[model samples]
Target: MKETYGFKTVPITLRESYSASKNGWSALLLDDKNCKEPYRSKKYDIEIVDRVGGGDSFASGLIYGLLEKQNTKDVLEFAVAASCLKHSIPGDFNLVSIDEVEKLVKSGGSGRVER
Candidate 1:
């Protein structure tokens, strides 16, 4: 499909099994045809306050990153981080700002309280 469509990369979100400490989620990025390995984002530790709108948040973040001209890896990271954060908030809307999502991405989704 990628070859037929001439896509540069494809990003997929995987919902991992829950562990004793946290629920895990990851994003896989497949690049060009000759690429041997896909770039994988770090597993995000999700508390999962609400699962609704998680996918939407991820898609929105991906679009935002692409619109901002972020690199493939960065875009994947941003999307996954946004989705992770969405799981912690109640309701169907993702209320987080870009700064919050970027902070989560850079911090590796540690869930630390920011002062």
Candidate 2:
């Protein structure tokens, strides 16, 4: 598609797996020129509190990251982390702020409460 349509990049989200206590999520970012291999996020193990709106949260995070002019890798990580955090909240909407998502990304989803 990049060759035929002159596309530069494409982003894809994957629901890697799910178990009784945890759900896994990943993201793949393909950029034709800069990235030789697809940029991938580390598998995030999210404790599931609600299943609804996870995908929406990911999409929203991606869009928000892009709008905020974050780097490609940071954007992907932020999106996955945001979606992972969404699973821990008991609602259809993702209520996490960018700071919270950034904290998750930095802390590697440790599930520790901020004091």
Candidate 3:
């Protein structure tokens, strides 16, 4: 994976699996510190139009947070929250605001009402 992605070394917490009959796989990235967050928030409250670009949305959010010099915790929260919000819509792109992601982060990814 590292060689393909042009990395010097593989991730220390690396994992990989394949299924001959399966078509594809899903990836869920979590920070050990953020384990308290839910695996998946309420779906009835969300309307997912597309789920294709969620991964890219997450990466972009993480990168943006990191570039802003946000703390590791904030970065992870923003990234995951952005990814989650992306699921509420269709397509590969999630049109979300950084503030929205941060709001979800502040609420612990519950998608609760913001004060």
Best prediction by TM-score: 1
Which 10 consecutive positions of candidate 2 have the poorest summed lDDT?
106-115
Better of 1 and 2 by TM-score: 1
What is the TM-score (0 to 1) of candidate 2? 0.79
Compared with the true structure, what per-residue lDDT tens digits does model 1 show for residues 1-115?
Answer: 4779877767788887676336788888775633546888888666677888989998898888777744677877888888888887889999888898888877855655242
Candidate rank order under TM-score: 1, 2, 3
Q: Report the Cα RMSD per candidate.
A: 3.1, 2.7, 8.4
Q: Please give, for residues 1-115, the per-residue lDDT of candidate 2 as tens digits.
A: 6679876877788774667767567888776644667889867766688979988998888888766744677777887888888888888998877788888889865654242
TM-score versus the correct structure, for each prediction: 0.81, 0.79, 0.55
| Candidate 1 Cα outliers beyond 4 Å, as residue runs | 3-7, 19-22, 31-37, 111-115
**Candidate 1 lDDT (Cα, whole model)?**
0.77
Task: List the candidate numbers ranked by lDDT, top first.
Answer: 1, 2, 3
* Candidate 3 or 1, higher TM-score: 1
What lDDT, from 0 to 1, does candidate 3 have?
A: 0.51
Candidates in order have lDDT scores of 0.77, 0.76, 0.51
TM-score of candidate 1 on Cα atoms, chains taken together: 0.81
Model 3 steric clash pairs = 49-89, 49-90, 50-89, 50-90, 50-91, 53-92
